[model samples]
Target: MRSLMCLLFLVIFCSVQMTSSANLAIEVANSNCCGVFSNKKIPVNKVVSYYKTSSICARRAIVFKTIAGREFCINPETSWVRSHVDIVDKRTATPP
Candidate 1:
């Protein structure tokens, strides 16, 4: 009975630790703003390079790297960026 109680306590401690770790990871990911594209706007087609998510920022911005190597953040809700994203997704989904 003592051994069972110890095991239960261990299990509860591990679960709480996991939950805390997961939340910490999420908060860290959402706290850092993208240095390359903090506040700028540009056309989607002009984006020579781009990334899809908050991997580069605190929010869900479409980070675009222009031909000049200048980075800009564009809202993902814009029609231009959304349509281009759809096209890219469709293209990549096709079998070569």
Candidate 2:
């Protein structure tokens, strides 16, 4: 009876650990935060699309996805970054 209780406890502990890890993974995957910004200037024409980082992020930034399937995080306040975001937005905007 004691051994059975121990085995049940072990199973319950493992289940809790697995549940916590899965929750953490899901949170990380859902977070669209950028830890750092890239200083490299990506040509506006090369950017196929762009998106702003989530408000929950520590820093305000823009993410630009290039035609070559690469993503760059840039400071939203930068002049070039703002212009690039504007251009990309217009390009992707749906017709009224």
Candidate 3:
């Protein structure tokens, strides 16, 4: 009985430690995951509809959305996308 209890306790303790460690890694990764998909992949044999000819962002999102559904490409690369909004300012582009 004592051995069983000890085993259970150890398992619970290890699980807790693993979860906390995993959560920390998730937080760190998320902080840096935004806007990481800018590098384009050649999307041939796929039909992507563009929202507008003028806006590149809309077009890129359409391409992703068409393939993966509405929310697949949340933050895309701005430079690869043609933006009508002056979307990327020089200030934001330049490092402080």
Candidate 4:
């Protein structure tokens, strides 16, 4: 009976370790990708900054951060997205 108890404990420990490792791997993988894109347009004035998604991401996208500290993932090819990128670029280029 003692041996059986030890075996069961080992199995549970191994399973818990495996589950934690899997969750960590998934988090690492998702950190580089934006899972969804926002279709709504955010006014340029509301944008605080922008950045491009990682090259490894399947979807080409730009992430815009708003003054209110919210992030919006947008398709990079969209006309308005391009315009926003240009405006943000110019804003960052000049001296304050």
The top-ranked prediction according to TM-score is 2
For model 3, how does the per-residue alpha-carbon lDDT over 9-33 read when each residue is reduced to its tens digit? 9999999999989977776554423
lDDT pick, better of 2 and 3: 2
Rank by TM-score, descending? Answer: 2, 4, 1, 3
Q: For residues 1-96, what per-residue lDDT tens digits would candidate 4 score against the true structure?
A: 999999999999999999999987786687656889899899999998998887657787899999999999998888899889889999889786
- Count of clashing residue pairs in every prediction: 0, 0, 1, 0
Better of 1 and 3 by lDDT: 1
- In the range 1-96, model 1's lDDT, one tens digit per residue, is 999999999999999999999997887776635544354446555556666664534567776667789766667776677776665466447587
Candidate with best lDDT: 4
After superposition, the stretches of candidate 2 with alpha carbons farther than 4 Å from their true spots are: 1-29
Candidate 4 residue spans exceeding 4 A from truth: 1-30
**Candidate 4 clash figure, as a count:** 0
Candidate 1 vs candidate 3, TM-score winner? 1
Q: After superposition, how far is residue 38 of candidate 2 from its true place, in Å?
A: 0.4
Cα displacement (Å) at residue 26, model 4:
9.9
Q: Clashing residue pairs in candidate 4, if any?
A: none
* Preferred candidate (lDDT higher): 1 or 4: 4
Error of 2 at 8 (Å): 25
User: Sorted by lDDT, highest first, which candidate order results?
Assistant: 4, 2, 1, 3
List, residue by residue over 16-35, the lDDT tens digit for candidate 2.
99999998778768978899
